[model samples]
Target: MKQFTSIAALTGLISLANAHGFVTSPTARMPGDAMASACGQQVEVNQQSDNYGNIQGELQVASGQSDYSASECDIWLCKGYKFADNKDNVYSYTAGQTVDFTVDIRAPHTGVANVSVVETSSNSVIGSPLISWSVYASTATGVTANETDFSVTMPDDLGSKCSTAGDCVLQWYWYAESIDQTYESCVDFTLGGSGSSSGSGSGSSSSSSSSSSSSTAKAETTPAAVETTSAAVETTAAAAETTTAAPVETTPAAPVQYATTTFATQARQSAEPSVEVQTASAVETTGSSVVSTKPIPTDGTAQEKLNFVESILKYLAN
Candidate 1:
């Protein structure tokens, strides 16, 4: 009975072991370690516990190796360990986990003639993953062999998942060509806590604001001038009518006959001296020089009568 009880206990232990499948904790195992390692690269891993209650690790290459180094193995081991421990769902790793990531570079619709990149987040860029970035000529298959990768330290606030919190996104922008003009393409990497995705920074122009203000100023300044011009036109029209009326009243009614008559009367008065001589001669010849002499001749001509009377007065005084 004792033996049977011991066997039962052993059986229970076996069942429990079977239920919790055995997992090989990631360690520096020779060939496998080498295979898992990456040189001058960036890697990511998603780790989850399987139905057999064993931790399973799957490696993903976030960036590719441009050069080989000892640090790459270290990165691979660290990534594997993290997966085994199930510490985080998203992991960012540098160096190790030998895998190649292909990045296809495209010119903007405007296009780019050349491009350069810099790390806004990492400082160990020299001889690191940040320096290993590859450049490539764009093609139908992908970017040409000019592309490379480099190492960089991940920011503390990026790549973590969250329900309400947010993350810092690492951005990479490259200039390329389209139709011989330069254009830009950008990619973003998120870090430290996640929710819904968000974007980065932007730039703006004050020219639009200036244009709006100028339009408003023009509208404000023009209306008064237009009104003044209209008022001036009205005033000029009224003045022109008054001027036209005055000229009509002053200019049209005098006669040519009256002017000629006045001229003839003045001429006769000027000839009075000659008329006196003629009257004196007549008086001498007729001896009938009645001192008044019929007041000289007045045949219904007032101008001639006045002249004859003046001549008689002159003769009598002499």
Candidate 2:
């Protein structure tokens, strides 16, 4: 009877292992890249394995420039397990399994910057899960900041694993800071099922490896039309001055001279040129300057008058 009980116990253990299948593996190691703009950068989770399969996740970034003297970063894992929760201190999964993931990082300043991720799965209390990473600077700015998001698939063979589902956990570490600053901010991920699991071993699994982002904020400055109007007015005034007409000068003609003669004789000899020439001396000299003045049109406002004057001057100058 005792031998029969032992066989039954062994059978139960084997059945439980088969029901749990294999724990999903965490993503692979990703190198850090630089952020060169105030807008920040995005880093993708790139670990995967065929044995455990792929998982989706998302990342969110916010600036504390006004609240914090230095920049700080926080990463939230909406799904999966964390390294700290696992006994091995590193993500654990069945051998030969693969998991796919992605992350995004943003920069707060212009020029090149570096970012990195670390993985740890051993000696739970002594070391962090980070093993390898990539680093480089971003090359853009403002809305164009050197931010980018990428993804990769990695094999779960990077670390060891446990025998049951509750024994393992997955964790992530992320950082984004200026190369010039000594302080760097980091974020981690924790793992848990998306509330669909029942203890019976028969349940549904959802993807927790994708990310979604909200729209950017609108600009706060005024429109361009106001500036354009001011520029146009100034240009018109300048053109008017350049096109104004120059003043004209006039000279009075010299008085005419005539031979000495009487008015009565001149009248009687109007038909005779010689007599008319002699009679001209009797006429008195009259001086006059022909100063002609035309009324300036005043029907329009000052601006209209200015515009009109400007047009006339421009025509004359041309």
Best by lDDT: 1
Best by TM-score: 2
- Candidate 1 lDDT by residue in tens digits, 1-318: 896456345434433332221112111111222323442222221111111111111221222334334444333222222222221121122111111222333221221222122122231111222223233234443443534232223322322231111121112223233222121111111222222111111101111212222222112121112222333223244432422111122465563222123123311112232211234545444443334325456466888778777767666765
**TM-score of model 2 relative to the true fold?**
0.21
How many angstroms is residue 281 displaced in model 1 relative to the true structure, after the best TM-score fit?
A: 99
In candidate 1, stretches whose alpha carbon ends up further than 4 angstroms from where it belongs are 1-100, 105-129, 132-142, 146-166, 177-318
* Number of clashing pairs per prediction, in order: 39, 70
Q: State the local distance difference test value for candidate 1.
A: 0.27
Worst 10 residues of 1 by lDDT: 21-30
lDDT per model, in order? 0.27, 0.26
The root-mean-square deviation over C-alpha atoms between each candidate and the true structure, in angstroms, is 41.2, 33.5
Instruction: Look at candidate 2 and tell me the lDDT of residue 306.
Output: 78
